[model samples]
Target: MAKNTVQFQQGFSLQEFISQYGSEGQCHQALFQWRWPDGFKCPKCGHVRYCSLKSRKLLQCNRRRSQISVTAGTIFDSTKLPLTTWFLAIYLVTQSKVSVSALSMKRTLGVSYNTALLMKHKIQQVIKERDDSKPIASYIIQLDGAYWGGKKRDGRRGRGTTGKLPFVAAVSTDDQGHPIEMRFSQVRAFSKDAIIEWATQHLCIGDEVVSDGLNCFNGLDEAGFDHRVIITGGGPESVKMAEFKWVNTIIGNVKRSLHGTFHAISKKHFSRYLAGFCYRFNRRFDLRQLLPRFSFVDLRTPPIPQRILKVAELCG
Candidate 1:
């Protein structure tokens, strides 16, 4: 009801995206404006005045005569692809419930699989970095540790399965129980020290953290968070309890969406995929703003080379 209000509803349409970012010039204009809201300035000399080269689309600092391309220092660095192509990639990434895989990107964007994979990784890294720069703080955060991946032939089961990844899912709600913010993060494990480290990074002082009774979560309080552990004892009925209704629902949705969409994702790449899910969910209420906001974030992110992306950690 309240979420259906104009302020919280999604208003951005495909037509709107096309009109705003249809051409290379249009996307470049938006990037130029976002990259330098006050006008072009040399990163080297910090000069406000500059001259633009129409032939090469480069800018020169008036004071030091330093030259800078529109994407020199930003995420688009060294990119030979057109701005429209990048903008379309950003749009597809942001405007989906599940993620746009490399295969999907190749089909949709008309690129090779390798090129699509590179583009997807680059954009995913941008979203991950952007979310990492901000902290989530709310009155109430419903948290739970979850595992992903199929069973192993080693006969290990459940959370202890050999190939699974341990991720912490948290959804913050208002006093009335309406969901507000969410943070889904992949952790090294669900140990006490891990939870403590997570709390220190993602939460603020006095924020209440709600969780099913797990001993590992006990460390959150020691890290200065106001922790509340609700012991449901392990049972199917208890799992259906209203105390963690939204948290449970979100976890189910995340699992289903990921499993249903991708054929199979590598273990190390789980963090990036999870980051994409969180990025879309966290911005769900800001439907119309997702594309432009994500574009701006991409502009702020440093260009992530393939080798660097391969070694980057999503959680750390």
Candidate 2:
């Protein structure tokens, strides 16, 4: 079988994307390929051969009794919306730098707000699941914290802030000054325990870790990590690791995207939004493949609409 090939350019419009893989069948076929690269098999009977029921888009197990739809046992399971809408939502989320509002999604896809929110949450769950599986290690990682809040009041920054939350981020840097992996979280405090736990969970022991002077990260040496601290007081002269600058840039971009696009973010679901942002940030350079792969999930379902709209309203 020939490999599925997709080409995308920078500033590519959504209409072009829809034209490429616009149908539910096309999206389903890609999901089938991603789910089972080898071929279709019956999950129940462990049989390699199964008959495809084109009418229901299901694979019937010839050896045994139950019928399974293409979405069984995956994130797409139990969804009532069309697979094409999900695929489109995924594509939009991956392509956009900031979180896309469910209201916009509803208008774009012609679906109810509830359905859009549900689909967004489901996609976020899938992304979180995938991130949990792939741990970031064996690279130079930069650690930092940034605060996100609602719109600025009276042209003041970092003050008069309400509904703000703290986020800790770890970004793995490549030799070419590009980020290879990114992990983020919403936490109550940047305490020693919190920082250590976040580091241990996302990074391996041997990798080098760099951070700006934060007392919470003082004893990283005891944890088997080559930790370096850069003092922020002395401007660029106090900088020890240049990589932190890139990491800071990443954080700045994230904050700017959130503030400009969403306006305000709630603490309750900050991690989900962070995960979505991290996923997009790490894959920003690979929009061609990522966008197409993203376009393969179902987003018109009800759950996603609620989650997305609620988050958007909270942010606004």
Candidate 3:
């Protein structure tokens, strides 16, 4: 009967984004502030005083005379794009609920597909790195194993499907059983060793983990966490069970978002996409602050080289 606060909330709009980071100079100033919150400290010498050379957009450290731009060493390093454009890209990526694809980003930003893909991957790399550093430690955790990719026609099915990727979906909830954060991690397989390794890295000890009756989940017990299994047997009835309600709902939402946003996803680069989704979902509580917070993290994240960015690696 009551209004849903998160659904009805006022989110950050393009108008507000323009008002704040509308110009190149505005974006530069914002990046400077976000990068050096305690005032300008030289990255090389740690000098507190610096002279801003507005003509060339560099700062000279008073101590060592070392020069640096606010964008230097950060994800925006050596980028030819205007800071305003970069900020807009960040805004679009953070503000969307279903996530943005590189092709859609190309159309929106009026850039080539390759350039847009580069920008998207760079931003997602920063997000993936940031989220990977923080592990889920919520009191009540719900976890489920899932697979991505369409069915193969070779008669192979379910977990053994040739083209499918195995992944674990975990939702951390509050005392009232509402999801507060989530982690989507790709795994080698649903074997005991794999589950133990993933759980050891992603989940904290002493937290209770709720899951269905999958034998692989016994690894959670071996990992020394409090594990509770609800045997919701397969089919529609199982998915409808209350014990797995939020986890099932989240998984469904994830599938929908993937189907609606992306046409196809490569297996190697899939982890970053999952990490990007988790990053957005975990930070969904404050839509207004999402841009600034994401930008702040972006400024702190080191620039990932194009060579490194092109390679696929595992990330949660």
How does model 3 fare in lDDT?
Answer: 0.84
Q: How well does model 1 score by local distance difference test?
A: 0.79
TM-score of each: 0.90, 0.81, 0.94
The collision pairs in model 1 are: none
Leading candidate by lDDT = 3
Model 3 ranges off by over 4 Å: 152-160, 311-316
User: Whose TM-score is greatest here?
Assistant: 3
Q: What is the lDDT of residue 288 in candidate 2?
A: 66
Question: Tens digit of lDDT per residue, candidate 3, span 103-164?
Answer: 88888888877777778888888888888787885978999998887565776334446558
Residue pairs clashing, model 3: none
Model 2 agreement with the true structure over 73-181: per-residue lDDT tens digits: 5556777778778778887777776878767888887888767766666677666555655667436888877667644666554423455676777888876766677
Better of 1 and 3 by TM-score: 3
Task: Flag the better candidate by lDDT, 1 or 2.
Answer: 1
What lDDT does each candidate get?
0.79, 0.68, 0.84
Tens digits of per-residue lDDT, candidate 1, 23-85, equal 978987888888878877678987799887778878888898888888875667787788787
Model 1 vs. true fold: TM: 0.90
